[model samples]
Target: MKNSFYLILIGCVLLACSTSKPEVVMVTKTIATKDTIRIANDSLDYEVIIIDAGFSSWLDSRAYPRKYHSLNYLESKNQLYVSEWNNRVLQPQLYNPNLYEMTINYDPMLRYGYEVNYLIYNYMIYFQNTNKQKLFGTVPTR
Candidate 1:
């Protein structure tokens, strides 16, 4: 199962590489096996595919537990983080294009349930910490 997920991550990375759009930084290292986390809500038609090497472990160990924060708080934080992330995506010359690869189309009006918001909020925290990028509020530490 783990191997399969890594394969999927590799495939996604390869597909991204094949894009005609030029990247600011070209890094062509044969990706070693890495963790790929897929969070999906079928009824809501939302899916988050995180293809980072240590993300899964960090999430489990460092991220706040589910339900630790209110849904409203999570939603608000996600909105801020996603907006910042998208802005960074637009300004690759200023920010690392590799870190902000794609823009997140997160609708603030939509209620993606607690689980979705929780993961997103935590992922933003993880992303910020790993990249040394600070978002709106102080990131939670455990």
Candidate 2:
């Protein structure tokens, strides 16, 4: 009977150890290719932006259903700055700033249907004063 009780205790200990959460690691690297960015394994719902000198075939492949509207117009340069409205946070103080500035380098081709290499920039926006603070907050302790 004593041996059986010890066995049960050992089993409980093993189960508890197995259920412990694993640690997460963060690493940053720059991309030098035209491939779509891989989503992080631990990422939740977050906004993203891509700024390109012009659109690419790769961009079309990863395009979301929602569309972006032009945010500002530069008449002198004849260029329009655009942003995804769905990714913007509607907070008074939290401004979704543009993060990337890609310059086009590729020649115009029939496949891509463009002559300029697109300069692309990406941005991730978060609301500063939303109840969704827990989205970026620390994990709770039980």
Candidate 3:
């Protein structure tokens, strides 16, 4: 089996304060290879990249199509997942540092559109199922 690659995208930090909204930091090492799963909003100039080698193929074969999950459902689940993921990132002692690498900055207030939310939501699901870890409760089944 091929080893899965993991890279921290360090997605946008959606700080509520007006003056300190940091832009998304793109990892220069990886660039946009076919294996990378990227979600970008040009207007906002914020982007997210999931650099898991297995994610691309898993998303295609295992995950349900975008239509299967509604925008609200995706956003809501992402809220839960991102919050827990960030928590795990903060406390590496408790959670595996390998599984929870970096903090994901996702703001419910800022609309990331359907595609962005869809990809992020599915990525979390893939992450949990593949890693045999749960960002929330149980490992979600497709």
Candidate 4:
């Protein structure tokens, strides 16, 4: 009887020891590429190269539809938004004055295209994002 009790106790101890190991879990993180520009005690950062608020809106608008618009349609729509932003930049603006103040040279804004418009557009986006403020009137729903 004593030997049987010892055998059961040993079996129980072995079982407990066998099941006591902790599980190992592996986690993966995504690293995004961001671009940053610093000038004279000022810092600007952007996540994407493209920067038009209208283009951004159009980009978000495509998520639910999951369809691509024609190049003409996209260009025209984005151009409208870009022009609106350009006009706002020309006049006195209410939101995020630092963005305008820091880089408020409008002499080159005469030409309205991807390169010229997106430069200031990117600056506004970087300023807004860095400051963590939704100073812009429009917010993308998606």
> Which prediction has the highest lDDT against the true structure?
3
lDDT on C-alpha atoms for all candidate structures: 0.62, 0.23, 0.68, 0.32
Pairs that collide in candidate 1 are none
How much does candidate 3 score in TM-score? 0.77
All-Cα superposition RMSD per candidate: 11.0, 22.5, 5.7, 26.6
Order of candidate numbers by lDDT, starting with the best: 3, 1, 4, 2
Instruction: Rate residue 56 of model 1 by lDDT.
Output: 77
Position 123, candidate 1: lDDT: 67
Cα lDDT tens digits, model 2, 1-142, are 2223223322322332332233323232223235222222122111112222222343444432222322121111112112222123233245432321221121111111011102221111111111122222342221
Q: State the lDDT of candidate 1 residue by residue for 1-142, as single tens digits.
A: 4234334433443333332332222222222235666655443333446666777788778887878889889888888887887798789999886666666666665555676567567767877787688766676667
| Candidate 3 overall lDDT versus native | 0.68
Q: For each of the candidates, give the backbone clash count.
A: 0, 11, 0, 0
**What are the per-residue Cα lDDT tens digits for candidate 3 across 23-91?**
443322223465886555555566566777777888878999868989889989989988998999899
Output the worst ten-in-a-row residue range by lDDT, candidate 4. Answer: 38-47
Candidate 4's C-alpha runs over 4 A off are 1-67, 93-95, 99-140
Question: Whole-model lDDT for model 2 versus the true structure?
Answer: 0.23
Error of 3 at 25 (Å): 22
Task: Assess every candidate by TM-score.
Answer: 0.70, 0.16, 0.77, 0.30
